[model samples]
Target: MARGPYEAAIPAKIADVDPQIDSRTQSLVEAATVEMVRFDAELGRDSAPFAALLLRSESASSSEIENLTAGARKVLLAQLGDRSSVNASLIASNVSAMQAAIGLSEDLSVENIGTMHHALLVSTDQGIAGEYRDRQVWIRGNSPHSAEFVPPHHGRVMDAMKDLVAFMRRDDIPALTQAALAHAQFETIHPFADGNGRTGRAIVSALLRAKNVTERVTIPVSSGLLTNTRLYFEALGAYREGNVAPIVELFAESAILAVDHGRLLAADIESALRDYRERLGATQESVRKILELLPREPAITAEMAADSTGVSTATAYRAVQRLEEVGILSPAGKIRGVRVWVAADIIAALDDFAARAGRRSRH
Candidate 1:
């Protein structure tokens, strides 16, 4: 049954997950779940802006894991329809994928997984957008013979995926435990040709939302993974060795870290917006509207602001100029003759979030 440099890993036995986790592991999961619940409740119904921020952070970190790096400024610019770097496009695709995953959280299935994958690659590569790979795939090397890990052959991918989907739907295990297992299994399947890692991470976020561990906030788990990239990969390897505890522990710890980091970010943004509003000192309606929109979009163009606020182009320009004068926004240079403005404080907070998350891994 064994194949390539790896042991036989197909037909993932996810249905029969281990029932008894140690008391310590259970305690960790419980504490992490509590933190996640608290984080979600604090965001409440008006969480869209914070959710967008966290998801962007998640997308950037997840893509970085694949060695695709893009800074917050470039990503925020891309969100405003600016022409950004190639890596920004890939990270933007990841953001779309995360959104798709959230939408599909209510029903986790093989077909929905395909839809998420399609959303991820549709903007970049059309050929392998939704379909599972039809040929063999390997990780970290050019060929299966020399790869660090060769997944199951192409013929067995769908069967393995089916098993994983079934497991994802089960409620027997703790949510974190189930998410960890499902992620490991999906990575083992390596269903897609080029986006398995990002997709797998998306599944983790989807599982959290689906299970109500997080209602409106997508805990920045990738930020935690980026914190210890080696440990994350090592946990995946440990899962392959029939030691699921490592990955489960990693997920639990990551959830805790994400909640802590998210709290700091939420505070920073609230303070920044307060400072901006105070500085403006009862601004015009149009300018105030733009301020409301900035949390969800740290970067904007006059056209984007006008479209979002249903105002004239000239009005939008005036509002932008007012905000710029108050130093609430700064011009981030021109993109194709159109001006782009960035909320510098928000971008700085996001960059700091990413830096703190990745700092441990660099040491």
Candidate 2:
């Protein structure tokens, strides 16, 4: 098969297209969106930190969809500013994009999408982090002629993204359905050269947040998509072929799975928190504050703990020592020259969640 010199795919404008979905799909999407809203509400006002854990879980699962795998330990290390493991660091960077998505959810503009893309890859590819591709790129093969999918030429990218952002501004569409369509359109745009998949998934997250489908936490739809990756890719292909329902149905299914899986992981993290509370029975105010911060920063130094908890470094170290004594924090060795400690139960809970959310073929 000849490779290269083929015309790029010019995706249709979706800004005003009111695509219809079947009754079954509409029902599925409605149910999933409700469950997602319920789950986020149920997590409640106090469980906000669990939001970080769930976001990291989604980031890890999303990274796996791109074949970037890393153990929980190394990822925790990377989160602590250690860059020894490149994949772990990359996966760690994904959390930033997810965060940027939710933070910028109120205004889903092309500039903010680029901001999310920048947050995703700035650490790894500063050159292309926030900028749209200036050249044509293809998927899967050495050249465009042999590629599985070819996105639009660089000349069309800005306009394509503008249309996508315009489509996102519409409130008539259902939440999950809109998110699915936006994601498919983003992938078809392939706006960036390296981090499109991650940013595309982040766009799904941003829509979910903007639509208020999930208010407190990220629902791990990426992990749900991870459960059957071939099907997910096939759904994207179907969307590009003018069949939008498949992708909508996929997001519906993915949302249901995300909520189910997220509930289980939340239970695990909450259980660990209970145990930590039990171990520390009666503790100082600073110690109490540090315990609350553990799930978000399982691996940390006294400095980070102090900064996050608004306690003195000495007080934070004392609290860390107490937690270390009670087995809540164990030595994580060192990042650079500073000693770090980890909350073993929290990391174990995270690892367990990651293991359960790992790849599985759908029947």
Candidate 3:
């Protein structure tokens, strides 16, 4: 097949990035980092609930950027092993990818990036999982001739990714700055046949963790980017044009927004748990364990409760009944005659967080 002229323009190598930024931008990055650190500290060591919420929010928003949409209720239900629609499953895959990215943050490399991508698409498209593109690909149009952007040829993808990994290893740059460049450069490379946007965003979370800008939770930066999809794309475009400032600034602002929103979410969850405890009135061991699990698994079946809480099925069922009586867990329908219950308040909070995160930005 004949290659198009645009192939010549593909960036086959990572540019030499200047880590230095003006004082004002530096301050903004510093402020964002401070908020993230503070938020992580507040979450403490046992931050499963907050971490779950942030990961779900990030996954949902990142999927939404690719026109995949699913409601919080559906996603929560799906996570609990309920009957799931295609969109819900896709978001689930995204959550898996995000989790993998977090786990692999300690060792960032092209192979691990492929692992993240593989986790993301394995369920939906196994053929493309964990593999770089073997053919030319373009975005936003039917064909390369009319596409908004054409990535480098598949032949150059590995070299480009190697260069990106090299850039990521440098310690001189600010963490946020390195993250911004890494994400933008990954998108520019478009190493995979599909799932680039999502995989790229997942890298942001991984980078935050890798650099220790965040310790316990994955800040939902994609939620902030969801605030202005057009602007996000524009920032990527600007980066492709050799103007890296837009992406760096966008990332800093997004980090600040994510931390602020995450704190609100954490407070709400704590309040909900407190209210549940008061209503339950010094609950039994099983009930208390269920409450602890609610933050991480807002929806669950009796079987799920048993597995998670290490209780007998009957004990889990009894606890579910108690939770239901207190309005902490409401029936959310059944799957194969097995009842499902959801922490409605937690689901509502998650939905609200997703909505607010994706709300169009005024600035």
Task: Please list the Cα RMSD from the true structure of every candidate, rounded to 1 decimal place.
Answer: 2.6, 1.3, 2.0
- CA shift at 256, candidate 3, in angstroms? 0.5
Candidate 2 clashing pairs?
none
Off by over 4 Å in 3: 1-8
- Return whichever of 1 and 3 wins on TM-score: 3
Residues 1-363, candidate 3: write the lDDT tens digits.
334565424673554667546788888888988888888898898897789888998999899988888888898776655545888888988999999999999988989999999999998899989999999888877778778988888898998998999888777888998898899999988999999999999999998899998888999988878888888899999888888788888889988888878888888889988888889987699989988899898888999999988999999999999999989999989877878998988988888888788789876
| Candidate 1 off by > 4 Å | 1-8, 361-363
Q: Model 2 misses residue 147 by how many Å?
A: 0.7
Best candidate per TM-score, number?
2
lDDT of 2: 0.90
| TM-score for each predicted model, relative to the true structure | 0.94, 0.97, 0.95
Cα lDDT for residue 169, candidate 3:
79
Clashes of 1: 0
Clashing pairs in 1: none
**Candidate 3 lDDT (Cα, whole model)?**
0.87
Top-lDDT candidate index: 2
- Could you tell which candidate, 2 or 3, scores higher by TM-score? 2
